[model samples]
Target chain A: MTLILTALAATVTIVFRFAKQKTAEKLRLGLLALMYSGAALMWTVDGFAAMFAGEPFVELQNPSVVADDAFLGICVLFLGAAIWAVGLIFKKATKKAV
Target chain B: MACFVVPAAEAVVVAIVKKRADKAAKLQAEALACGGANAQTNTEQKARTKTHSGEKISISKKLGWLNAMLWGGTALLFLEHVWHGEVVFWPPFLTAAANPADTAAMLYEIATSGVAMAVLVTLVWAGMAIAADNISWVKAALCKQKEGANQ
Candidate 1:
């Protein structure tokens, strides 16, 4: 679930990038892109790991794995928020420069 | 244990970013102040306004993309998860069960995943708006470039 959600997030951003060419070219927005894409990648890897363990994204009975994934997904949200906050600060500082 | 890792990493990231932003702000302000006399201040202010608009355009563009990526991607992934039946709507997780523990779990789900879904939906709306607004500039730019090449 974590992987799937993050993957969708990544896809949305990519489509937005192409749809809005002018805005997509900025460096600050790159941080946002990185945050979502990075989280998606993490979830994808976790999914693969689950498959390796002979379960498709963990057996429904395994609360432990699901709990971990949920927590990780939450963490990814925080990380993305942090990156966004930093980017905004940077934007303000460079307001007149660029 | 690893849950703390993301927070720890974010703390460090925010701290470093704050320092850099502050330093840059101070330096840029100093340069602007010292590099010009009162007579040039008006021109500097004008320049600042120009850059401010430019910054707005830059930010709006990026914000649009961010909206699309985060919300859009999340939507797709969520739908996929639902289709896969990987989502467990158990007593403690998705609903307020008879037990207090289950109630807490239900609240947790409402707080996190529910909020995330709401946010994604909102961002998708905004992303569509911005993407639609900016679609024209791209076509214009391409057309102008082709015209220039032809001439």
Candidate 2:
């Protein structure tokens, strides 16, 4: 599920944020952590809401459905990375302009 | 439901604030330029403001970090909802709006899950901004200790 993927990404980013000093800060690892963790939080809330609505929080689905969910999750992951990349590019461009 | 809208809305507000801050910065820079230059003092002030990383970022820049997080998260969640057919390109947009019962449920989701996401992201960003600003202090202390050791 998307939740699990984002949560894992958040965990890894947070660890990198704290463990590495120079490279992590240069890469803005904290922003990446924020993106992933925010998605994970949103998904967590969605899961709880679904459960309250009498739906399974997460369930095994048809293979196609599962595949679609997996694909969507990957896309979400890439989207977050893309946003971070754009931010970095913007920052670099602004620095150059200055 | 349309849970992503909450953060998207917040992003809009933050964007306006950033714009105002940027305009103010620009005007201040212009004023500094117009005034007769105190080159030596200006250099001294710049040096005093410099962080270990070389520049002390402004409040606006800190807001930028939060804006990016909110916008990025909102986009991702919106995409996921669209993938599941909860959102559509048609009028009303939300699939849940077709039925009254579903509409109520969607509203509930927005009230709880949507608001929670916005609040949580903002809280995290607050913590991040505090840490980012304090990093200068921490690094400066360490540098001083290193200089002491050298002496």
Q: Pick the candidate with the highest TM-score.
A: 2
User: For residues A1-97, what per-residue lDDT tens digits would candidate 2 score against the true structure?
Assistant: 7788888998998787666645666677767887888788778777887788798786456677667777888999998999889888897899799
User: Model 2 clash pairs?
Assistant: none
- The whole-model lDDT of each prediction reads 0.49, 0.78
Report the C-alpha lDDT of model 1 over A50-80, residue by residue, as the tens digit.
Answer: 5766878644467986776666555555556
What TM-score does each prediction get for chain A alone?
Answer: 0.65, 0.93
- Model 1, B1-151: lDDT tens digits are 0111232233344446556666776777687787669735975676556443322233333344444344433433443344344333564322235567766765554454444443443455455445543556543442333233334
Backbone clash total, candidate 2 = 0
TM-score of each: 0.35, 0.75
Off by over 4 Å in 1: A58-75, A95-98, B1-151
lDDT of model 1, residue A87: 69
Query: Which residue window of length 10 is worst by lDDT in model 2 chain B?
Result: B141-150
